[model samples]
Target chain A: MNRQSLKLSMEIARVHLVSKPKQTIVAMLGVTFGIGMFIALVSLMTGLNNFTEELTMTASPDIHIYQEETSSRKSILEEINPDGLNLVYHQKPKNETTKIRNAREIARLINLDARVLGTSPLVSSQVFYNYGPVQLNGTILGVDILDEDKLFDLRSKMKAGRLEDLLSNHNGLIMGKGLAKKLNVALGDRVVVTTPLGTTITLKILGIFQIGIGVVDNVRSYANISTVQTILQKDQSYITDINVKLKDRNLAPLVASELQSKFIYKSEDWQAANATYLTGSMIRNIITYAVSFTLLIVAGFGIYNILNMTIYNKMKDIAILKAMGFAGVDVKNIFMIQSLVIGFLGGIAGLVIGYGLSFLISKAPFNGGDIISLDHFPVNFDPMYYVVGIVFGVSTTAVAGYMPSRKASKVDPIEILRGQ
Target chain B: MEPILTTKGVNKFFYEPEKFQVLKSIDLTVNKGEFLSLVGKSGCGKSTLMYVLSTMDTDYEGELQIAGQRLTGKSQNELAAFRNAHIGFVFQFHYLLPEFSVLQNVMIPALKLNRYSRKEIEERAMTKLKMLGIDEHARKASSKLSGGQQQRVAIARALINDPDIIMGDEPTGNLDSYNTQLVFDIFSELTHTYKQTIIAVTHDDEFANKSDHRVEMSDGRIVKS
Candidate 1:
């Protein structure tokens, strides 16, 4: 309990561990490997998880507000006649607009909320790309170039030209890499796009980008909002969708519901849109923790076995110490000090090794080949993981060392001295 | 002529083989500076009585007082502290921690007592080792010493804390005649020159006869003193 006895116990523990260098090193190595693997595995797995989540975030908005089509409502004749002959034969459905009314106003109002980050107005249309008799069907999204860039980080994904080019060249279009390849058009080349309403226009290819999703990369392109409006023969107020970004993404659902109720449009959150990806990330996290703990527990068992053996081998020494008036707690502290020293040293070594391995992994070349754009493997270097790793390593060794130390403390000196 | 250790109606039993009594109504008093030997045939309960007197065996029926402190019904930790401060032990096998230097083994009990500074403890340990004539080998591992030298080192360790009483369980059992005589002389010198009280349990007739008081036991009862 006092400082002097603790110092003595530590000294004794040091002698014991030093006397059995082989067993001590072996026990330390178990902890080192367990913690090293834990750090490396967690960093890499979380990095991959972040990458997928980022991809989803870049491809979609935190909340999307759009006009959803509805089925035919009850006829006015049925309301007048009450319960008699409610259905009319061969009734024609009324026409509806695929545009959110007052879209710019809604976007401005949504942006004013403190939780909202930004909003981008978009006009999406189904169109056919025509290049010298090669016709391919695709969807073109017309967006305000600056707002879209701010929302989707589109500037980084550009392969050929900048997003600002779409602003300068009124009729300029930035097509997906796969779409550009299919249409056989390069930058500065013109491609005729035909709208479903039979309106056609020629647009110069200003840039190319890749979204890394095979379907999106093959069938999507972007143009200026005015260009799309001109081709569709609509007026200036022809925004079809409003995409909202939020400061805290977790609030997307709550904000979306509020916006949907307030603006009378269908609002969908990112989590709802990317449920599969969320599930995948959760499962990966669970697997990472499960394997990491298993490794640590196995390492703990190594320490336990070695400490038990050390106690067994030093039975006579323990008996003598007890007879000399070292209390049970003192004997326990001696062995506990050995285990804690091993844990601390091994944990630090493990951190260094883990960092080294992670650095190497981050430098390793990776080729995603058309589906993803990556030059090196992703490895998250979060300091929190190192803290967790070391703490877990030491605590596990402590737990493992406890029982053996207790057994040593309970040794009966009379029995041993009598036997001798 | 002051009584340093006294016991009254002490009774002990062994329950593993069967419920068998080991010590029966033991009543004894050991005076200060007295060199006492407990001698008996094997299983006559001399060693069991020594263990009880040393406060290492507390599962007994009656009162045990050492240096005017009641030792019965006390916790093991308290007893250990008492032993460290008041009673020293020299075992049959000279059970020094093999990994430690001879000096460190000697200094352990004093360090546990923590009544003196580290420098003082070290100096005292060196003086005890010198007294035992093992100071030259004090820095060497205890296991590397010969049996006679190791027994002397154990004796030096027992004297390091300047305990009120020294208890030995066959302290020279494994030694040759020369080492046994050397250990007996050391014990005799400790009690006579330093006024240290000692109780030893042994089978050696010569060792028992030379002590100031020899208590002989038969069938768990003291037959002669």
Candidate 2:
């Protein structure tokens, strides 16, 4: 009833658990191994997801404004010139006026919304870089470079020279170190950049950067947006996408809705674009639950075995109980309590071992690289795991204890003495 | 005097497909604090009647009562609870939990009783063990005790719960003469000191003759004493 009796009973159960030391340790080892497997597998999958999400974090918007554009084709070349590559593509350009007007007007529209952290304009174009003999086709980004550090942290990671060279110098550019290396370009080297308008402009590579993003590091070149727009001789209307930032993580959806309504009605929020997170979470949950169910049932088998043996051994004791005016239910409870203790102790062991192993693995060298990702495993053992585990352990033990305890209760002290 | 334990025309039979009558019509009673012995040969239904009075088995056609309650038509749990509150039992084999010490074995019944405090139960168990002169062995495992001493411990354990009636089934059947005599001597002391009703099943006429009253049984029928 109290902790004292519970302690005593647990001590008694402990003795019984270790009575067959080899069996007890072996059984516990099986559970530990199973739980450790759970930890390892879950951590690996979560690590993979986190790594992918980390990659997304590097490239995706602080907040993305989605237009009604289906992003099926990936390669810049394939997306721009679909019919030229044996595919009959007949997609027309979007209404540039509406898109540009909406993106440009959001800066003046909202009345200083607290959740509106920042808004940035983005324009991406496929441009070719010409060096001595290398012609590297790469993404030419026209970033504001104004408070650019807050949005992407890219300028801070400049491998050589100064990031200001791209802004102060009118005809300056910056490419990732790998991209520069591939194009045989270096700091202060002049290169020709062809924009989507088919206008070629000469730019000096004042700096090179490396941020561990293979996709970005190998194929990205950036310049001042106004310089690109002026050099291309476009109009005062050239905002491809407007990236918005929210003050708090929880306010992202609400802010996204407000921004969508206030900025551009057709723009998508972060959650709708990151559907894989929701779906991946559901899949991970299902997997974790299925594994735990299968394993604890196996663990329950051990509990069942222990209780069954205890009940069989204590048949005469149960008969004595009946003779002593203990009802069958009381006798059942004694054994039931014994199993519960076993399950509880074992469950705690499993949880600690499971979560502990996951933590160790999380710190382990499991991730495939050192770029934008982890080397350790990951395990998010939420409250749900504990609730399920304890319930499963206790109920399994109780059910396991049920049969033998009931059998013990049915014993007749008289019949037992008389050998009936 | 109103008997502390009684049975009226008790008839018991074990029936599967074949009906086996273990006890015939029998009437018996023992006054409070009296030591009574039921002496019979093997298969004479002495054990059956003992079980009936101890409330171990309730399926029987008889007016069997212990302490104050009628012992028929009650559920098995009710019978078990009844016995737990009122009856203490000893067997000839000295059926103690070998895993426990002598004191622990004696305290088992009291631990099952919610009414008894742990200190009170231990004190009661010690008192019984001391009276039977096995106090010094209380801490020793029951399995390690000498046979006579072990039987004495068993008697002490049966008396530990302070039941209104103590029933022994062939209490000395498995013991040597020394242990057997030791066991009967404890029963005598139990009756005299605790004013307890003692009913023992025995094959030895001499052992039964020492009781305040003796009933003899033959072929499941109680005939003479």
Instruction: Specify the highest-DockQ model's number.
Output: 1
Q: In model 2, which residue pairs have backbone atoms overlapping below 3 Å? A: A66-A268, A324-B84, A325-B80, A325-B81, A325-B84, A361-A377, A362-A377, A366-A375
Clash pairs detected, candidate 1: none
Candidate 1: regions farther than 4 A off: A70-95, A131-133, A211-215
i-RMSD values for every candidate model: 0.8, 3.2
How many clashing pairs in candidate 2? 8
- In the range B1-225, model 2's lDDT, one tens digit per residue, is 667877888888888768988888878878899898998778788877887777766688879877778877887766666676688887866777666789988886667665678899889899888888889999998889988888788777777767888888888888888877777787887789778888888888889888898988889898885
Per residue, candidate 2 scores C-alpha lDDT tens digits across A61-173 of 54676454543334566778777765446655544432456456765453267666666776666788876565678887777776455666776677898777777887888
Cα displacement (Å) at residue A359, model 2: 5.0
TM-score of the second chain in candidate 2? 0.93
Query: What is the DockQ for all candidates, taken in turn?
Result: 0.86, 0.50
Q: What is the TM-score of candidate 2?
A: 0.81
Compose the digit string of candidate 1's lDDT tens values, residues A132-155.
877799999999989988898888
